[model samples]
Target chain A: MKVLVIGAAGMVGRKLVAALLAAGQINDKAISSLTLADVVEPSGLGIDIAHTVIATDLSEEGAAASLIAERPDMIFHLAAIVSGEAEADFEKGYRINLDGTRALLESIRLASQSEPYCPRLVFTSSIAVFGEPLPAVIGDEFQQTPLTSYGTQKAICELLLSDYSRRGFVDGVGIRLPTIAVRPGKPNKAASGFFSGIIREPLAGLEAVLPVADTVRHWFASPRAAVGFLLHGAAMDTAQLGSQRNLSMPGLAVTVGEQIAALERVAGPKAVALIRREPDAVIADMVAGWPKAFEAKRARSMGFVGDASFDEIIEIHIADELSGKVAL
Target chain B: MKVLVIGAAGMVGRKLVAALLAAGQINDKAISSLTLADVVEPSGLGIDIAHTVIATDLSEEGAAASLIAERPDMIFHLAAIVSGEAEADFEKGYRINLDGTRALLESIRLASQSEPYCPRLVFTSSIAVFGEPLPAVIGDEFQQTPLTSYGTQKAICELLLSDYSRRGFVDGVGIRLPTIAVRPGKPNKAASGFFSGIIREPLAGLEAVLPVADTVRHWFASPRAAVGFLLHGAAMDTAQLGSQRNLSMPGLAVTVGEQIAALERVAGPKAVALIRREPDAVIADMVAGWPKAFEAKRARSMGFVGDASFDEIIEIHIADELSGKVAL
Candidate 1:
């Protein structure tokens, strides 16, 4: 089996690559070759696998076609501009997020027409698809009324994924992942970056800004669990999905207080105290509209798993990102 | 105020044009000019309004841009291939329905860049946006999982409309019309054409085929009511719509038996006897997945009205299409 990972330079993508290498195979088939693609060449793996890293911008015309010409058995599409960036740069967002995704799908469709090709396509969507006026627990059948440009792009891609899959262009599964907690990297510009920073920073003996109150609740999953979702989605029985190919993945819904308690439990009060309370109304207002929780009954029933608590999430980060060790 | 009707040659479009002519004004402003555009030039309405009819395909490049350059104050986009046609001709369906609508929106957005140009964009969406595994009554916030290619296109367009509106690109309103019953013209190849055919043919003293069972329930509105919806959508205060611009319009939900009863009540048993029972498994299966009813609480609260009952629908057909007379 061959695998193609788009956005392979990103944090999740790098972790997913590591996970794939660790397993050595998917669905009992040895991954003979791997193609890691992004706008910049991904590096630092240094693994003994037949892999090629390519710097490619999919938004450019003919780029997607050229990439799909290789015809990997499974394609994990995780390429996208972050939410804050997309909202700030509208044209760039639509060009990269919407047109780029469509170009990829179209390229896949064209490729299938030339030869018998139906690859397992796993797309990473986001909970940003759900916006304000949300229910207490967003159900499996909640409507997607994204309030942000980034969310709109994701929602549109979800629609296309379902349509293309239904039309037999590709065997697609779109998983709307929860915000990755304890994201193993420096703080990014994403409004939800604080979700990870508040944990990652404190664990490294650094102060992290807390923009919102302790009551501010949100959904979360560890990078390891997100990788698990992609793998399971690729290997699972898509026949069980019916026509609705996109699903909101299950995650631990926790408030800031719960997260802090989990931090205290995992790394003691010293780590918890490192979180500096700095109320930023702009970020708070933005976070307020986000999805708090979801009754991801469909994905849960389909066997997609997530971390049970923030403590477990932190543990996964330590194991995966910190080599099972955290700085005191 | 100048008004542009994109699909002015079609059934509802023609009625909408007539309605506009009858009203002479919209939102207390006299319609100074009317531009009617379609694949075929619309004619025979020799009203004393400054109007121009053009045969144009919106899916063609530069067509929408040129039209938007004219800067019509109100743009009613009612053009689309019907459900059956779209399902059969996949590429053409997406080209005209999805790409064409997007082209128009993009053109409007581009036009806005030159100057402050936010026109009232009233788009005609459909009940096809909702598919099977449906609730007894689809509410204001139901997930759009369209089964057919046509439904998929409409659903995608709705998302784009909402996104564009939210971004302040255009003042847009998308009204999802119920199946227009007692259609004036001859039956087309649409799967839902039978809904109008049964009542329309019998009222004309001709035998009409009923493909689906009498128990099969579906939503309905008159051509007049559909015209009313477009006009109302064009003139209504969109600020009240907030971010969710698309809405399922209010309609009468009745079984085919109730429809027949209403037909009999309006035009006597002689007319009802003209209906032929033809069990078409193909159309029956197609009809099975259609929307039966809708809560449409949002649209109702927003003051978009529909016929009270099937009887009112029949009355509308007689009054609007049959010159207030039904063959008895």
Candidate 2:
């Protein structure tokens, strides 16, 4: 089985590529070739597989058609502009997120008309799909009323994916991933970036700003688990999904205080002390509307795994990104 | 205020046009001109209002831009291919329902850029947005996991409406209308046609087929009520909607048995005798996945009126379509 990974240059996409190459197969089907695509050509995808890396923008005319021309057996679409950028530049967000995904689906449909072609499509959605007036624990069936253009784009793509899949044009699974914690990278200015920075920076002996209070709760998963979700979405028995092709993946719900407690458990007081408290009301207000927790019963029943705790999420980050080492 | 009705030729559309002409205004604003657009020219529009009737398909390349060129102050976008047809023809369904609506939105946004222009965009969504695994009484926050392509299209439109409205590109309101009963028309092959047929045909002294069991329940409103929902959508204070611009319009939920009883009560047993049970499993299975009832607290609280009972729904048909006289 050949595999195509869009947004292969991004953190999760890169990890997914490495995992796919490490396994050398999906569901015991021998992987033959790979196509790695992004806005910039993906690099250093180890020499174990026959692969081609293409720098492509999906929303451009004929871009999706060209990408699907080779017809990979499984496709993982993870391309998106971050929420801050999408909200700031409305036109660009719709073009890249909404039009791009729709173009890919349309291209696949057109390709299928030539002969028979139905590939397994795994799309990465986000918990941003859920908005304010949320329940304490959002069950498997909460409405998707995204409050941002980025979230709206994801929700729209999920609908398109389900409709296209139901029509037999493709086999699609959309997994709404939690906010990945301990994201293995330097902190940027994203409001939610603090979720990862408060862990990653402190582990590196760097003081990280804590914008919200200790009681600010949110859903989280490790980057490793997010990649696992993509794989599971690729290989799962879609028959169990019935008509609803999209699902919110299981995740750990933790408050800032709980996260700090986990940090203390994992790396002691030194790492925990590195988090500097600096209240920013703007970020706090935005975070308040986010989904705090989810039941995710359907995804769990379908065999998708969740991290045991915030400590486990941190452990995975250290193992994968820091080579199991802490600066202290 | 100038008004444009995109589907002035459809069942509810024709009724809406008639009501608008009769009122000569909306929310006390003196109505000026009208633009009636559809796949075919809408004819016989009352000359009380100066109007332009255009035969236009919204999915066409420049149709939406042309429609919005004059920029009517309030637009009612009620055009769509029905459920069964959208399911049968995939491409056409996406073209007409999905792309057409998106085009209209994009056009409106572009028009706004030239000058300050934000129209009251009242879109007619359907309860088809909600599907099975449904609660006995679906609440305002129920997930929109539609089982069919038509429902999927409507749900997508609702998302776009909310997003666009939130962004200040348009002042939009989407009302998810219930299954309109006692339709004033000839019998049709649509799966849910029986919902209207049993009442419409019987009242006209004609035989009507009942495909599903008596216990099979569904949500409904009358032609008059459906038209009222549209008018209210156009005239209501959208600020009350907050970021959620869509709503499930209130309607009566009744079983087929209750419908027949209402028919008996309204036109006596002679009219009820005109109904014949055919027991179509295909239609039955399809109907099974449909939403039964909704709490509709949100729409109700917003001052949108609902049909009092199934008996009122039947009475509406007689008063409006039958000229207050049943043929029995």
Candidate 3:
């Protein structure tokens, strides 16, 4: 089966592609065609399979139509503006996140008119869809009242997913992913980057600043669990989803103190020693508004699993990232 | 105060205008203007107030901008395509519902940028925003999984309302109205028309068909109660609403058997004879998907009230419609 991965150069996108390749679920003997598209040309990941990497911007008028012409059986939609960037530039956020998604859906609709083929659309949503004044554990039935523009965009896309799926133009499933902890590589502009940087930088023997206090709690799922959610979402029976297509994925709820303790346990006290506590008033206020934990019963019932503890998350990061890399 | 009614020629629109006039809310002595806009010219309401009736199609470009240029202090957005019509015509539905609402909001935004005036926008949402397989009583926290195109449009509007309100662009409140029963007119193209028809026709000494079975339940509020909800919503302390601007108004949940019993009690057994039981499979299936009851705790807490029972609904209809024409 042919597969198309949009935003294929991003962190999770790269991991997802690697996981798919390692599984060898599509074809064993002959290499299956894989199309990876991103704004920047993906570089140096040892992708030796029959894959085509296209460097293209999807925001242009005809770009989406061109992308849909390939007619891949499965489409993983992971492209979006990060939370900080979206908040800073409102117009760009709406254009890239909202308009881009709409253009893609419309292109799929127009393409299907030629010959009917409803592909499995896997959309990566975020817990940012939930806003402030939240319950301790947000249920599946909780109303979507997003506080940020990024969250608003995701919530809107969730609605569109349901509508499009109901129309039968595409079999869409939106997974509201938790904040993926222990994110590898250099830190970007995400406001929530500190959640990962606290551990990742320390593991690299570099001092990492903790913006918020150790008391602040937030939900987390390891990158491994995130990839697992995507795979399970792709393999699951859509018949059970019915009209409600968007789901809040399962994850672990841990406070910052708990996270540090886990880091100390997995990476030794020397590694944890690289962490420095510095409270950022702006980030602390923002983090305070986010939901502490979510009741992802629906996702749990659908076979999504997450890290039992923050230590497990750190261990996954160790196995995946620091196994053969320049270790301290 | 100046008032602008977007769909002033519609049934509820006309009633709302009349009620406003009777209450003397529109200051007639000063520069207070009442702008009535519709696809067709309004006629024969016999009001001596300062009013202008304009026949303009809102779907046309620059229509919303021109409408907002007047800068009325109160905007009643009652314009929308009916459920069946929206389901039948996809393009028209999206064009009128989604595009029209956005156009109007953009126009308001443009107007506000030049001046510092934000109008009190009361948008009329519907119970169609909720989908099937609902709990026994759907609360304010129930996720919007719209089963129809019309509901999707309304849900989108609700999202926009919340975001715009949070941004302080407009003081907006979306009131999710329950199905109005005992409509005092001929049947419309809506699938739920039979709900009103069963009561209206029988009360008017004419035979009406009951499409669904007696056990079929539906959530309802009288047209008067709907108007009350709108009035209360318009004047309520929006500061209490915070980020969640839209609210589901309270209504009575009554089954068809209960309605018949109420009819029997009010107009005796003879009037109940006008209701001919004709089981329509299509309507029955449609009815099955609708919400039976709503737990409108938010609206109730905000001081919005409705008819307690179907008997009260029938009595109010009689007192409002046939007070002098057909004495009980």
lDDT of 1 by residue, B10-122 (tens): 98988899899999999999999999999999988776889989898999999999888789999999999988788788789989999999999999999988899999999
For candidate 3, what is the DockQ-based docking class?
Answer: medium
lDDT of 1 by residue, A100-211 (tens): 9989999998999988899989999999888878998999888999999899899989988988998899999999999988888788778888989989998888999999
Better of 1 and 3 by TM-score: 1
- Tens-place lDDT per residue, model 2, B155-244, is 999999999998999999999999998788888878899999999998999999999999999999888988899999989999999999
User: Which 10 successive residues of model 1 chain B have the least lDDT summed?
Assistant: B182-191
Best by DockQ: 2
Q: Return the interface RMSD of the candidates, in order shown, one decimal each.
A: 0.9, 0.7, 1.0
Error of 3 at B273 (Å): 0.9
Q: Candidate order by DockQ, highest to lowest?
A: 2, 1, 3
- How far residue A62's Cα lies from its native spot in candidate 1, in Å, is 1.1
Instruction: After superposing candidate 2 on the true structure, give the runs of residues whose Cα lies further than 4 Å from its correct spot.
Output: none
How does each model score on TM-score?
Answer: 0.98, 0.98, 0.94
lDDT of 3 at A118: 92
Model 1 segments beyond 4 Å from truth?
A: none
DockQ score of each predicted structure, in the order shown: 0.78, 0.87, 0.71
- Looking at model 2, the pairs that clash are none
Candidate 3 has an lDDT of 0.85
